[model samples]
Target: YVTPVKHEGVELNILPPGEDLEQIVEELWNTGRPGPEFRELLEKSGAYNFYDFIIIDSAPFFDVRYTVLSIYAATRYVVVLRPSIVDSRRTARMLRRLMKYAKDFGLSTPDYMARFLGVINLAKSGTIEADALLNLKFTGVKPSKGFNPFKHPSDERRKNLEKSIEGLRKVINFSNYVLPLNADISRLEFKEIIKGGKSDNDLKNTTENLLKDIWLHATCQK
Candidate 1:
C-alpha cells in the first residue's frame, strides 16, 4: 500500500499500489478545475490530512504501470537500487526509460528536473563499491549506512528479506527518509508473510529514528 504524509505547509500526495491513476486524475478534474476538490479527494482517501509529508509505496517490478504512474505523479522521484550488478543495471535502465518517457511527454524541465530525487541503496554487501559509484553518477542518493540484522520467517527467509530490505532501505534513505529495518516487522506473521516481530525497544527505537529523520528532512527542505 502507498502511504502519504503531509507536514508543514508543503503538500505531498503518495500513490501506492492498487490505485488507479487515471481514475484518480479523472476524479480530481471532475470538479471542473484542479483545486479544492482534488485536495478534498486526497484527504477523503486518507492520502493527505493537513500533514506536510506523503509517501506512496508502489508495487513490485512486475507491476510496471502503477510504478510509472506513481513516478509521473510524484513531485519527487526516489529510485531504490541494490549493490548487486544485476539490480543496479535494472534500476539504471528503469531510470533511463523513465526520464525518456517524461521528456517525451513534456514533463522534463528545470522545475520538474529537481523533482527527480535520487537513488537509494538497500541491504548492500560484497564488493559493491564500483556499482555504488556508478549509481551515484546517475544522480542517485547514497546513504551512509545500511539496515542490517533483518528478521524473517526462517533463516533463509531472513537472508532473502535482508537482501530486499537492504535495497529498499538504501532507496528509502536516498529519498531522505530514514526508515529503519525493524526486527518486529518479521514477527508479524500473516499466514504468508511477516511484517515485524522485534523487541519493544527495537521497534520503538526504529520508529523514533524514522520520525526524527522525517522531521529533519522536512525542516531542511523549508
Candidate 2:
C-alpha cells in the first residue's frame, strides 16, 4: 500500500524508511538480486494507471534496497541538484550505478537509458562556479532567477549573492540545459500558484518549453 500525496498533475509517492515495508525491502536487498516477486509487487502498485508520470524521490545512497527498487520501477528519472561540482559529480556516479543495475536486469537498452532527466536548482547567472554543471552530459533545467535563501541581503551583502549566482550559472551552462528563470515559487505559495491564474499559466508555459526537447527525445526514436 503506497500512501502517495495524490494531486491532479503530480503524485508524490515517498519510499519511507524504518517501517514494515522497509523491512521487506531490506530483506530483498540482502539477497543481492531482484526476483519475480519484486517485479510483480512493483508493477501491481498501479502507478501507471493512476498517474501520467511518477517521480520517485529515492534515497541519496545506493546501498538501500528501497532505492534500488525505486530505480527498477522508474520509467523516467529527474535528478534535481544545486549548481555545484560536488553535486554534479555525485549525480554522475549515481547514474552509472543505476544503469549498471538496469543492465543486469536487461533494462539498460538505449530506449530505457534515455529517460533520465537532470535539473539544477538555486542557480545564478554569469558565474564560474555554475560552469561546473557544464561538465555533465544530460538535459536539465535551471531557475530563471537564482534563489536567495539569505532573505533580502543588505547592500553590503549583495555582492555575495551575485557571486553565488555566477557560480551556479556556470554549472547550468555546462549541462547545456534550459533556464526556467521566473518559474520558481516559494514553498508557501506553490499550491496557490498552481491552483490557477497567471502564475499557473506561467508555470505551464515554462514547463512546456523546458520539456519540448525532452518530449522529442523520448518519443522520436527511429
Candidate 3:
C-alpha cells in the first residue's frame, strides 16, 4: 500500500556557507537581475503556488543585497523582533523606510499601511523589557514627535530615553498578535507536531489573529 504525499511545509534549496550567494550577485549584475526577481524566482520554483505564505529569512541589515531584494519581493511583511530597546528603535526606522519605498513605487497612503500585517507581541511575561514595551502599547496615544533616538549625541541619558520612546511608539502601532514568549516552539517534540497534542492557548490565538490579518489584507480570493 502506498501512502499519500502531504505538503508538509517549505522546501529550502539552501546554499552552503560559501560564495554561492556572491556568485548569484555577480550573475545578476551581468544579466540584470532586478530586486523583484527574487520574488519571481519564488513563483517560478512552484513553492509560491503550494504555500499560502512564504517567509523569507534574510540576513541582518548588514547585507544590502538580500535585504533590499527581500523587501522588494515581499507582498507583505510581518515584523518579529527581539525583546530589546535596540530592536525597537530599529523597528521604527525600518517601518518608515519601507513606507517611503512603497510610496516611491506609487502606493497611495491608504493602501500603503495595508502592506504590513502586524508585529508579533514578543513580550516575555514578568520581564522588565516586556513590561516597558507593554506600557507603550497600553499608555501612549502615539509616538511623541521628534522621537529619533540617535539625535542627541552629547547626552547619553537623553539618547537612551529617546530610544525607549521610539521603540514604544512603533510597538503601539503594530502590536496585534500576542505570542507568549514562554511558549518555546523551537524545542517542541515531533509527536507534538504530528498529533498537535500540546496546546498553548497564546500560540493558537496568535496563529488565528495572524491568519485573520492576512485575510483582511489579502487581495487573493481563496
lDDT of the candidates, in the order given: 0.44, 0.51, 0.53
> RMSD in angstroms, all models?
11.2, 8.4, 8.4
Number of clashes found in candidate 3 = 0
Task: Encode model 3's per-residue lDDT on 109-149: one tens digit a residue.
Answer: 54655565445445555544444444444221122333433
**Top candidate by TM-score:** 3
Lowest summed lDDT across 10 adjacent residues in model 3 is found at 138-147
lDDT of 1 by residue, 1-222 (tens): 545567557445554435575586566556564434544456687644554565566653755555655554445555555445466556645654555555634654443444544343343222233223323332222233442223222334334433543553443344432223333345543222212333444334434443454444445551
Q: In candidate 1, residue 191 scores what lDDT?
A: 21
Ranking by TM-score: 3, 2, 1
* Stretches of model 2 off by over 4 angstroms after superposition: 1-18, 35-37, 44-53, 62-64, 105-109, 130-184, 187-208, 211-222
Per-residue lDDT of 85 in model 1? 49
For model 1, the run of ten residues with the poorest summed lDDT: 134-143
* Candidates arranged by lDDT, highest first: 3, 2, 1
lDDT, residue 37, model 2: 51
Q: Which sections of candidate 1 miss by over 4 Å? A: 1-51, 101-111, 124-222
Candidate 3, TM-score vs. the true structure? 0.59
Ranking 1 against 2 by TM-score, winner: 2
What TM-score goes with each of the models?
0.41, 0.56, 0.59
